[model samples]
Target chain A: MSDDNQHQETFEDFKNSFNYGSRSDLNFKFLKNLSGEDASHFFQELLWKIGDSFNDGDFTRVVDHVNETQAKAYAGVGRFTYDDSPFTPLRAPLSQLRLGLMTSSGHFVAGDDPKPFGVENMSQQEAETRIDDFLKVEPQLSVIPMDTSIEKLRVRHGGYDVRASMADPNVNFPISRLAELQAEGRIGELASDAYSFVGAASQLRLLNHTGPEWVRMFQEKKIDALLLVPV
Target chain B: MEAGGIPTVVIGVHAFRDRLAAMRLPRTVITPHPMGRTLGAPKDDETQKQVILAALDLLETAQKPGKIIDLPGRYRL
Candidate 1:
């Protein structure tokens, strides 16, 4: 099917799931206000909101205040698929496995090598202006090894508040905490390096291409287990 | 790449736990926190360590793949 039809079907499915039992006119009217891309982003955020409330069993209440007929629409698109590599279990004990940290928070330290996003050196205003450009920077086509220490680390992500992470990089990356774990013998060893990149980009090409490539890089470290921290 | 012989686990907020489970990557631990502060509030070493330990524990105790364990606490910005 063409992209237009697929988007229409997606909107229809979202309307059915979200506004069930509501008036058809109201549902279609709300959907009609949205462009195809907006419809997709709405569905994505709506799903995240739903996922947050899944444990409460109060999902019906969550949607009750959506104001179906009067909601404004914006433009953006996102999609997710379930296709993934097969599952692999941790065969070795924690004390015997090597661990690594990978984050989407886009961390770097001063005096380190330059990164793709270039936001680390940009002024706040410049970074904000160039946010979309950073998303296009798929450094190394996957994950890039971060050469940073706790004292030198700085947070450069544009998608979320970076204050917490800047004050203490462990807020997002948790490298210091992980090292403490290693010292305590809670884990065997820490990888010589960690990985980071700005992840709020809406690019599926980077997501799909990075998975296998990330695995290849981590494998070189003989990393027995990995901790994926997504923002 | 869990299927490629390296076991992996994800740490994210409750908002993305379902998709993480659906992704079927491996084990996942959801915390009731914001996106950037996945481990917990900054400077809270004890709580942060606990969160990491909980997720790492799931790496071993999860009976099946795609299991999501909720860390016991709330950290709201």
Candidate 2:
């Protein structure tokens, strides 16, 4: 057989092997054991811990008693540690899926683009001056197309040792590797853009707003799946 | 947001495993590495590629929500 025929046959074989029915069949069976009475008890225990083990303290009193660090810690526990959200399943075959990347580490390529995703091209001093405002107005989701040069990339995360990523952006946002996979046919294709967010943000309001907005943007980009690298 | 209809697989540090579990994330693969280097040591292409592939594999094989799998190996500073 000719090379084109062999390639077509292999592609067909892959599609046939993919579990397309898995999406419709998707169910939250992971939480099956935590139901009814058990679930109620579990949530109560979680809540108690988040409230700083409150037994008989007034809300105002509790707020006044805890330090800033303690307050933030408890607040996060109360806000994020919940299992009530719904989940979608991966139904497409790995070979046929279009993948996107998101990093909690604030890494982006610098350039003179009107897209206010990251502080691109400015000196570190200038970027630091504008970082707060940049984070504010910039959309919760930023799109990064593949083939963006590594030379243009920079890491702006304050919460960790960024030296590694500074030397090589792929340490955090491995777009180069993703491109290789695409070329090798290990995956279908990459979305035109990837995304970035500062994971160190402590404000629940900001996260609560941005998280779903990011999801909507991902869906808009027609991404079939996402690989999130969280620092 | 997995519950919101996106299938997300997280490659994160082990330090955040408990918190990630609480957040009820979809498929998660944890490495005993520090915060910033989620893929592996910087410029270590082979290791990074292996790690990325493993996380994608988790996206396919993970059966339920909040599934956390430990990837083999520790990343030293």
Which candidate number has the best DockQ?
1
Error of 1 at A209 (Å): 2.5
For each candidate, how many residue pairs have backbone atoms clashing (under 3 Å)? 0, 4
- Tens-digit per-residue lDDT, A111-153, candidate 2: 5333334444444334344445554543344456677888877
Give me the runs in candidate 1 sitting further than 4 Å from their true place.
A1-78, A83-85, A113-120, A139-148
Candidate 1 residue-wise lDDT at B73: 55
Model 1 clash pairs?
Answer: none
Q: How do the residues A9-52 of candidate 1 rate in per-residue lDDT, one tens digit apiece?
A: 45456554432123233223345556567666666777876887
Candidate 2: how close is chain B to the reference, as a TM-score?
0.85
